[model samples]
Target: MAAIDHFWAVIPAGGAGTRLWPLSRSSVPKFLHDLTGGGRTLLQDTRDRLAPLAEDRFVVVTGRPHREAVLGQLPEVAPDLVLAEPAPRDSMAAIGLAAALLERRDPDDAVMGSFPADHVIPDPHGFGEAVRTAVEVARDDWLVTIGIEPTFPSSAFGYVHLGEPVDGHPAARHVQEFVEKPSVAVATDYVATGRYRWNAGMFVVRPTVLLDLLARWHPAFAADLRAIAAAPERLDELWAGLPKIALDHAIAEPAAAAGRVASVPSAFHWEDVGDFDALATLLTGAGSVTVLGDDDLVRPVDASGLVVPAAGRVIAVVGLDDVVVVDTPDALLVTTRARAQDVKQVVEGLKQSGRADLT
Candidate 1:
């Protein structure tokens, strides 16, 4: 009923996506990749999708190294809107810093929304509408989260159990409980019950309310954040003192336990794009791909469920189903689709073996 102006957005784009190795290296995270054929990076798509709300309203929290990449993709964002983290301190620290910085601009009442820059949302209109609704609901002093309706039993994502429906709103419901990544059996049961949603890690709330919740649940962390916020220039020193914890584990889960959180089923089609398989699903249509190897060999293959990111390199996959075949000049990765989730471990192993070139 009310116009949703004065709403602020924080896009956290600092993580190094190691799972999508070769393509998703430390120098280039998944968010910076042009996974979709639309010629825009995930961060660019995210910004474009939310541009209706105004570029000035957007605030991006990223590491210093990623500042140039983020800026290159999002030229519309003002220089100050991009907050560069001195070091990697996790989501809680990033959120706190963004909220504190935003507070200086608009104080307690301004509504702030945080989203992962690497996510893929197919339905942009529905996503925008859901965000507006969440912003409106956040005005009631509740930390509002946009939860994706689970389409399958996914072990890679966290789950949120929906409680009673929020009064006067059919689409919104009170969050009964929060569950971390569950076993396959548990995830299956959760989907069968139809009372759970995938935790998409998108949150909307007022700065003061979030700070209050953090203070109540985590006093020490809150004090540290407050100190950082007071001396914004020394954020690096303060961040070093802050504990490394996700916002969900540190604040959201605890606040939900105290009966102060709400969730709206995100109507938009969403994907976390955590690994190569998931990334491929987002890229390809039905099932087929055209591969060009050396000598300009035009080979049409039936790639029902495969992720191939090698464009200018020579690649030849004869018999591989549900496999991720990534060929690069320096390294190659061949793994079953199911085991694609372990690519991060492979990256770690490469680092341990001093194979920095592979990583």
Candidate 2:
């Protein structure tokens, strides 16, 4: 695909991924790892996927601690483009700051797309097509999000309620509303209606328009972001006072209500890799043992799950099904796939017990 003109890819790469503990520590988050056993890290893969469209136009917003690591992984992106926050203020501040910077840097023609650095999009071509469509729609002064076509009733993701199609762009639909994650039964009903798509939080909008929409609801917050962008040094001083909120709550949801949001329905598969179970599903199928590291280090008698031998120690599983065993040098995790989401509790317990190093 050819590079999209005036498109700046904004990457938000600041999450601890507490559910994927031990391997995904605060010092080195999950986005910095190759959880899928792929050659490149998740952050690298994300940059590669956006490179075709961004064409060297990139802005990576990450925490101060991981700034050097992000730069190390994405050496192609200019050092100045990698904005590091002095403190964690959530997605709104991260992406909003990027918007403010781009609005100032390319005020006349900057159109920015916000994509999380941790997501795994296997089909970059389809993703690009969706992004291209989003850029076209965004040029008409509407906030655009690439909505994933849900393959199943997934209770884990939020849903984008689709309304009528845009007048000229039939593939792009007006976003009626954004719904929170629903129960399985409710998700099934949503899928049955065929009027919903998974909200992947992929947004494309003109930098000026994004800040203006933000200004409508959060005047001071928007002003602070632009002020930091203008004076660069005030980032730490104003950043602390910014409301720590997700972009969806801070802008997208309200924008949809005001009839200013549109969505491009996409068929590509998207995976957040939120936990070990998701990682196992992405790596291998059911009824088999999948090793992320050296296969020789894992021996399974009747195991059907994931085993990561990161410590190079021999791990033997016998008569176990749907189990997750991640062996790190400092910590080892053994649990069932059914309880993968609960792994965060273990990290919490370790932190409360003064075992922060293990987490």
Candidate 3:
């Protein structure tokens, strides 16, 4: 695919990823690790996937602590292109800062696509096709989001209710509203209707359009972001006051209600790699032991699970099914696949116990 003209890829690389503990720590988050065993970190994979479309046009918004790591992983991006947040303010502020900067950087015809740094899309071609269509739709001043076709009723992801077909773009649909994550039963009904897609938080919009939409509901917030963009030194002063809210609640949901949002439905395989269960599913099939690191280090007799021998020590699993074992030099996580979501509690406990270094 050829590069999209005036399209800049904005990557937001900030998350604790507590569900993937030991291997994924605050100092080295999930995006920084090779979760897929593909050698490239999730952040690198994200950039590589978008490179064909955005080329050298890239902007990475990350926390101050991980800025150097992001730079190290993606040296193709200039140092100035990586915007570091002084403190964690959530998705809206991080992405809005990119929008505010791009709004001024390219005032006329710049369209920006915001993609999370941690998502794993196996088929880059399919993703590229969807993004191209989204960029085309965004040119008409619509807040376009590339929605994933749900493979199952997933309560973990938000849903985009598909409305009427877009007038000009046949591949695009008018988004009725953005629904928050629902129960499995609710998500089942949504999937059965065939009118909903998982909201992957992948947005393609003109920089000014995004900022202007944000301005409608959050005038001061928008103003502050633009002010920081205008005077870069004021970011520290203005950032603390910015509302700590997600872009969905801050803009996307409201825009959908106002009938200004569009969605490009895609069937590409997308994985957020939220936890060990997800990572295991992505790496291998069920009923088999999958080692993310060196296979020689793992010795499983009757185990069907995932193991990461990061500490380079021999890990032996005996008569266990659907178990998760992640060993690092300082900490080890042993749990069942069924309880992978609860791993975050361990991180919380460690933090409370003054063992922040382990997390």
Candidate 4:
């Protein structure tokens, strides 16, 4: 497949990644760490995965504090294209701002694809093909999302309700609605229906169409984004006034309700690596303890879990299964896979105790 002309890859790289504490911090979020021990950070890997489809057409929207770090990770993306938000707004503002800027630069027929910087896709070829189909569908003015074919009934991610077959695109379908994360039992039922897909938050659309859809639900928000795009100098003054809302609630869901959304069912294996459990699943080998860093520094006896020896200290796990141990210079996290989500509570405790530096 060839590069889609005027297609800009917009990356939203702002997240606390609290559950992945010690290794992932607000100062240097998960996207900046090589959680897979794959040499490149998640942000850099995202750039690599998107490079073929987006070539040099890229825009990264991140928080002001992480702007320089995002540049350090992605030297290929032009500095001018890295937009920094003065404050932390949700996905709607981060992605919508990029769309608005592209809407101004390319104006008439430019397409922008928004992907989160922290997610991992092991199958780039399949991902590119899915993106290509999505871009083609987006060219017809439909807000297209790359919906991953469900490998299992996962309660971690939202589901895309697949409707009728789209007229022109081969694998595309009209998206009936976007379902929130369901209970495991409900998710099991959703997977039983072949029409459901994991909503990967991968969207491809013409910038104008995106902003216009946003304008319908949030007129002032859309206007503010456009105004900031028109006068980049005004972002500081105007950004504070914009409502902090997610793009899903503000546009995608409503668009689906209006019969304006389409989905491309994708086979590419994707993972958000939301917590230690996800990271363990991605890196762990069958019947073995997975060490993300310096395997020699880790010693396990009848243990099957994830161990990160980031502190360069020897870590010994004895008779443990499904455990998570992450050691950094300043902090260490010890927990079980069943309670991985509780790590965020540790972060909150640190913040309240005025030890936020350890968080």
Q: Which predicted model would earn the best lDDT? A: 3
Model 2 stretches astray by more than 4 angstroms? 285-287
Off by over 4 Å in 4: none
Candidate 2 has its poorest 10 consecutive residues by lDDT at: 279-288
lDDT of 4: 0.92
* Cα lDDT of model 3 by residue, 133-158, tens digit: 99999999999999999999999999
Best candidate (score: TM-score):
3
Give the range of the ten consecutive residues with the poorest summed lDDT in model 3.
279-288
lDDT of 1 by residue, 259-348 (tens): 889999775799888887777666665446422123243233544445454556545555556667776667778787688888888899
The segments of candidate 3 whose C-alpha lies over 4 angstroms from its true place after superposition are: 285-287
Q: Pairs clashing in candidate 3?
A: none
What are the TM-scores, per candidate, against the unseen true structure? 0.92, 0.98, 0.98, 0.98
Rank by lDDT (best first): 3, 2, 4, 1
Give the higher-lDDT candidate: 1 or 4.
Answer: 4
Candidate 1 segments exceeding 4 Å error: 1-3, 290-311
Query: Local distance difference test, per candidate?
Result: 0.80, 0.94, 0.95, 0.92
Q: After superposition, how far is residue 209 of candidate 3 from its true place, in Å?
A: 0.4
Error of 3 at 44 (Å): 0.1
lDDT of 4 by residue, 232-257 (tens): 99999999988888888899999999
lDDT of 2 by residue, 163-182 (tens): 99998889899999999999
**What is the total number of backbone clashes in candidate 3?**
0
Instruction: Tell me which residue pairs clash in candidate 1.
Output: none
